[model samples]
Target: MAWSADKSYFFMLAKLLTYSIFGIDARPVEVEVDISPASMPKTILVGLAEAAVKESTHRIERALVNSGYTRPVDRIVINLSPADFPKEASSFDLPIALGVLAASGQLETSLFSEYSAVGELALDGVVRKVRGALSMALQARANGKKGLIVPVENSREAAVVDGIDVIPVGSLAEAVGFYTGVLPIDPVPFSWDDAVEEHGTYPFDYSDVKGQEMAKRAVTVAAAGRHHLLMIGSPGTGKTLLAQRLGTILPPLSAEESLETTRIYSAVGRLEEGESLLLQRPFRSPHHTISQAGLVGGGSIPTPGEISLAHHGILFLDELPEFNRNTLEVMRQPLEESRVTISRAVGSVTFPASLMLVSAMNPCPCGYRGDPKRQCHCSPMQIERYLSKISGPLLDRIDIHIEVPPVPFRELSARTEGTRSETMREQVIVAREAQRERFGKDGSLVNGTMAPQQIRKYCKLSKEAESLLKAAMEEMGLSARAHDKILRVSRTIADLDQAEFIDVPHLTEAINYRTLDRSSWTQ
Candidate 1:
């Protein structure tokens, strides 16, 4: 390699790299920087870099100088290979800076070649935490990297990635010391039990709700089957209370599910300060004013939205009808597909959105249309208009629709003798286990998300159960899609009872849950 006025010296240096945490699959990105000093003093970064990545030049230069390194003033050009793909974020600062230093003969590249580096660089050369540290670590492991150097703040998140070495670095000097073998980096060990001990049931429990046993039952079934639930009730009727308890009754996420959930949270920069894995299922309650993009996930650089954040968890819409109709309408596809694909002129990105939807709304404008104690002030037309705001297609997607009446004074003042969340959770877990066993052999799904073919094959009904379902469907004027949902719910009910097949009682209970559709059309 010879340096000339027109041709710069070519040096091929290898360094460990990590991928961006923005996209799905969390693929590893190789950060290859070609540093050459031939022309007049200048630094050029050549790659498909967004503003954040382009700005890394200033951060890297300041960091290198502050970290006691001399920058080659000779014209230096750095190229991040696979240059066609867009790179965004400050996480690349440390890697790009290290690559430049190594290529410029300031550091040994061989020492850092086996470990991926990801962090934001401060002007003072401190390593700051970057979003998607977990995703980066996972990508490092997948790419056969031996270790990862991440910011201390993201150490816990990166530690969740098993079978990989994660080194938490506080500053550029610490990272340099580890790479040069002057200072050894230790992996952060995480214990699931310790995480559980610290969080403790997430500060919300089913026992907190005073009453509304029917709504609780509906939610229990919803959790067991992963069904979408809609609760119609007046204000302060414990609808929100019941919705909050839905997560407690659900089963804990499997290791794979926890990782997937963590990836989405990391991508959205929602992973808590010290949290590694999201041990508990997510509960995302977006406000009614949220846009369709906010709900489904979209940006110039696509990021996980509320529904994606709620993946493998619960998505609760407090005032179901209050949400913009367009916003609600956009969810119908993801509800059926378990994922959302947002297309932009730049490109298209898909995000997982498999979640149990728990929505609540008033029966009428006055919030007293069906209340026993409160007199209805709204007219029939007003009530119809209010209910009509929720599209039938959206209503149809909801597997269970229950009317949550105000809790009786006696029950509210009672000694709270009903089963606690722990007990109810045990039952729900048992039911969910049965569903997992039944569905695990084929498609990865619970009862609620089963396909029509799965319903026909797995939700086998007895003669009596078939007759009961037929009569109910005819009476309720249910659609073909609703019919499958009924059978799925019936299957879950049978599983809850430890029954092998759908029976009359299970069908009866499943039919009872479709109260909204039955009442709305029948009345």
Candidate 2:
């Protein structure tokens, strides 16, 4: 390599890396760069460079010059570490530009090795926030890096990961100055206790809902057991109101669960600016127009879908029958397994989707098929077709299916006097605690997700209850899956009452919840 006229002998080598935020799990990547003087001046970035990464050369060059740094008029080759793993995004711009400047003897490269760099560089040299900041910070910390230089907007998101030092900068120069000690930067501080106290609970409390005692009880049981629930009713029957309040009754997520939820939001580029951790459980309600990929994830590099984003939270599907059949069908596997595996030509990525599914649909297209006041205009075939949109297997996976009747004028106008969310939440918390003790530390083994062995062990029914369930299953033509679901739901009801065994009342509630499976109604 020929030396420049300055003969300062620029030899800056910088660390480069990629970040993986599959769902909420963040993994680090290594990026390495080398620059040299050659007759032809060109810059090439290798290591599975995606479109955004390949386009970074221009952005980096402009950012460097604008930031009072010169781009070496030499053939430059920048290689991202782990050459086999794919690189995506404009985050590589700042690192590549800094590396080139340091190698050209324009800037010092000594401190570059100690810190992980992540930010999108603008044409005017501004460092923009990139997606997956939390994941990047985690990767940096895991690799034993001292700290991370991220964009200001992403500082809070990255700081959520404890023990990692996150240095927020406005532009490339600020990062360079901090690293070179020209300007000292402080790490963003966070306190989980403060976050909890500040974000106590949701603004929409359960007490706000009125005249749906049965529905409220169902919500409590579902929240306690993390069971999937389906509500059928005509329009304006308080289905959505009931569904919205379900989150308020649920217990707060543990620290680990909160982090897992935050990571997924970070990866999908949905994390709010300057927001650190998502203390509350997520509630994702994708529109009926959503495609299969939009619901379950897609792409050459698969990303999380709505269900994954709703992990550790609720996924409310209002007007459920309106959703595409194919889209609804895709949820069957994830609902059963509590995770979704997205397969592409590159590889398969599994995202956690352990969400409480709350879906609402009308009895028929006109939404008045079963109403006493209004006549059902639709034919029998129309009703059957609308209901058929949802598959049997998917229906069987749901633990509770109740009819939500519209409140009468008297009830709707009645004074609001119901249990507050705090009160219901306390009860739900107690019930959940009871379950946690029975199921152990792993939250996945809740009553709704119990296996055959766990069901037999925990859901030991009284002789009368067992006979009632068997008779109900045969009479309703319920599948084996439905039978299992009934047992799980009955166990949850029993747990709510602090009952040791499934009793007659618990079995009755469980059987009543299977409203859709009743042959007379569908017929």
Candidate 3:
């Protein structure tokens, strides 16, 4: 049970599997520990480890002695390979500790090669949760590892990743007992069906808003097709309310999407302890005072920004004009590419940012420019300056632009609710199913994400629809990008109507959404 010279290390070497998260994905690493009795009585951690691991060997020694094991009296060396890359996470602590115990003959274990382990260690030898446990489990499964040993708090999160066993350990002693076959451990239970049973439940619903049927319709279309939307209105017109409830009408994330999204959340350490797969789509509403780096993701070691956090979900910008122009402008590339690439001097990382951008802004600076109840106090210059903050190119990227009118007093006080989120959610689901069928083979997810090439193939228009779109383009001074957006929106309208072809009515309805393109707005 204690350290013995006969059972002690002669050819003492131990290597185990571990993982490191880079951006939103993970890569496997091998933790190798070497123990030499004849060398100096010191511990050294080498091979490009970060500052956090500088005292790792010392901590491992302390943890070993504290966990009722004799500390190795000889020299110690720990190396995490691939040695060329930077290792910065605290996940290396567990593997390093186990490797030392095995190499020092305190623990007779050979499961290190069969199982991957990731966790931080306390001086008292307790195993603390590490970030990206789910990501590590996935890497372990992909690399043909049989099982994963993680902190007890992370068992549920990593257990959801199928095809591998998850051994939850509470302390370093418990982990050593399991590895040495001195104790028993069970893998946690998690399933996809159990994760998605509570999908459509939401605290905010469309029925909460009295009037704004047009705004609801526009938002439904945007969700159905993954389109970006902009709502221009005065204060207290349900614009913010509508934006908040957009995700309620969206379908739950698919199994593949759930894994991908959960991995992203895990990598960022945003996932709560013991939480499994994230079935609900994310809805991120960042403040207007955010900077370019926070909005688009940039740092010494890059991190995911708000857009990436809102992946496969909505990014709502309320009071859009209040945001700094350059900060808002950072979204132009990700809007087109559905991904963000942040480059550092050492390396570059790319984060997925596929999301529905729903922004709301007042009609003017005073918030009463077009209100029938309130008088406008701002001059034309102030209005122009506020509107100018949002660039034309940026506006063109958005598919739908509509005005939210003030709700009537009777509508506000009426007991009878208008259309509810349940009704709209069903309709949106139907329309999205239609799009999934239409773009099944071409690899396009939604009409709004279609490129010009996919647009030419799937968004075919009838003659009547073509003529209407042409006249409206000329009258509104629409750009080519705007033209494509209208076509995409029109395609979505047809999908909503359950029609196969884009008819003239769908085209008219789509063109009507481009309210900012009209010359009267400028006048």
Candidate 4:
């Protein structure tokens, strides 16, 4: 790591701390730069850097001269540490420029070791935004660095992690001046309340819909317990509309959950500039034609899929039966495990998939089979073919299966509106608080994620409730998974009612939610 400045003295600037993002986590990287007198002046990158990272030499050269620094007339060698693993994109430009300056004696700073820098450099010296700034900041804090120097636009996002200073620089000259004590720029402060208070409301609301009280109630229960829901109804019913507004009724994300969710979005470069953090629960609805790799994560680089993008939020699949059966089937494991692992030739990465699933579909192929006003044209075989697309295993994994019947004309014509989202959100929050006390400080964890041990412990049923469940199981031929789902839904129902034990009415209501499960859908 030694460089000759004037053939008289050797300079060394090694172990410049930085980070590289892989999947959702950041891996620490040390950058080393050396400039030595040679026959010809050329830049070469070593240590298994990718093509995009290797091409930063030209960018760094042009940026230095534009920012009023002389390009060194010597052979330059920039090495990214841990040579075994390959580095990705243009995030290394600023770091490489800084390394060249630090190594060639053009920039001298005593506090260089205390700061970590990452940004894409424009040929005109303007520092551009890079992906995973939040992840890099979190890694810097975890690695005991004093501060992070990132693009000006990403300062707030990197500042979400406390106990570290986020130094935002607009250009390479600003960064160089700050490191060399030529400029003094204060770090911006981040406020959790400010993000929440300033965030605007979603355009849709519960009050906009007419009369699907049953579907609304099922959504409330699903929101209360984080349970997955499936709605079967005619096409004109408000099932899709209800699913869209489900995020409105769920509780606001916790501060930790907000940051965690923001990190994932940031890793994928999905966070828009000026948006600090994801303050609300996410609602992701992929089209029915999405591939398995797109639904789950896959590729040589293995970026996040739709499930990972929906972490700590809602994943709505509208027109459920229209999706490929294989695509629908792949969700079963992640639904139970709350995470998906994508393995490639290089390695494996596990992305968080802990989300509430809400799916809606028509009762038959014609969409008017069960409607009172519309005449049915499709035969029973056609209806069976349509319903058969949704497998039993997937249905068994879903907890609540309520039929969203078409709204009656009388109910739709009434002047009065049904319950609003605010009231339902309040109820959900109360239930969530109770569950937080029950499951400890992890308020994000809910009854829906409980294992068998937890189910046996917290979801205790009374003697009468147990007898009723036994009779229902005998008559309906429910599987062991279905039985446990019933218990889980009953526990959530009880939590909503503020009851200590699962009562008969709670169990009965929970059983009623399993309409598709007990019917001939499986057959």
For candidate 3, lDDT tens digit of each residue in 241-343? 9988887899877787777777888888898654687877888999999999989888776888999989888899999999999998999999999999999
Ranking by lDDT: 4, 3, 2, 1
- The predicted structure with the larger lDDT, 1 or 4, is 4
Which residues of candidate 2, in runs, are more than 4 Å off?
6-27, 474-477
Which pairs clash (backbone N, Cα, C closer than 3 Å) in model 2?
10-103, 10-105, 12-103, 16-30, 16-31, 17-29, 17-30, 17-31, 18-29
Write model 1 residue lDDT over 435-514, tens digit each, in one string. Answer: 87887775358898887788879999999998988888787776777788889899988888999999999998888888
Candidate 4 per-residue C-alpha lDDT over 1-523 given as tens digits, one digit per residue, 9 for 90 to 100: 4545456444565458788888888888888887766537888899788888978889899999999987877777888988877788688899889988888777888776899999999999999988899999999999999999999988889988899999999999999999989999898799888878776367778987899887888899999999999988888799888988888888777787788889889998888778889987888999999999999888777788899889988899988999999998999999988899988776788998889999988888888866889987988888888988999889877899888888899988999978899989998988888899999866557988888998999999999999999999999877778899999999998998999999999999999998776756534
Candidates' C-alpha lDDT? 0.81, 0.82, 0.86, 0.87
Score candidate 1 by TM-score against the native.
0.93
Total clashing residue pairs per candidate?
0, 9, 0, 0
Which parts of model 1 have CA positions greater than 4 angstroms off?
1-16, 34-36, 519-523
Q: What RMSD, rounded to one decimal, does every model reach?
A: 2.9, 1.9, 2.3, 2.4
Worst 10 residues of 4 by lDDT: 1-10
Give the candidates in order of TM-score, highest first. 2, 3, 4, 1
TM-score of each: 0.93, 0.95, 0.95, 0.94
* lDDT (Cα, 0-100) at 321 in candidate 4: 93
CA-RMSD of model 2:
1.9
Q: Which candidate is the best by TM-score?
A: 2
Q: What local lDDT does model 1 show for residue 100?
A: 74
Model 3 segments beyond 4 Å from truth?
1-11, 198-200
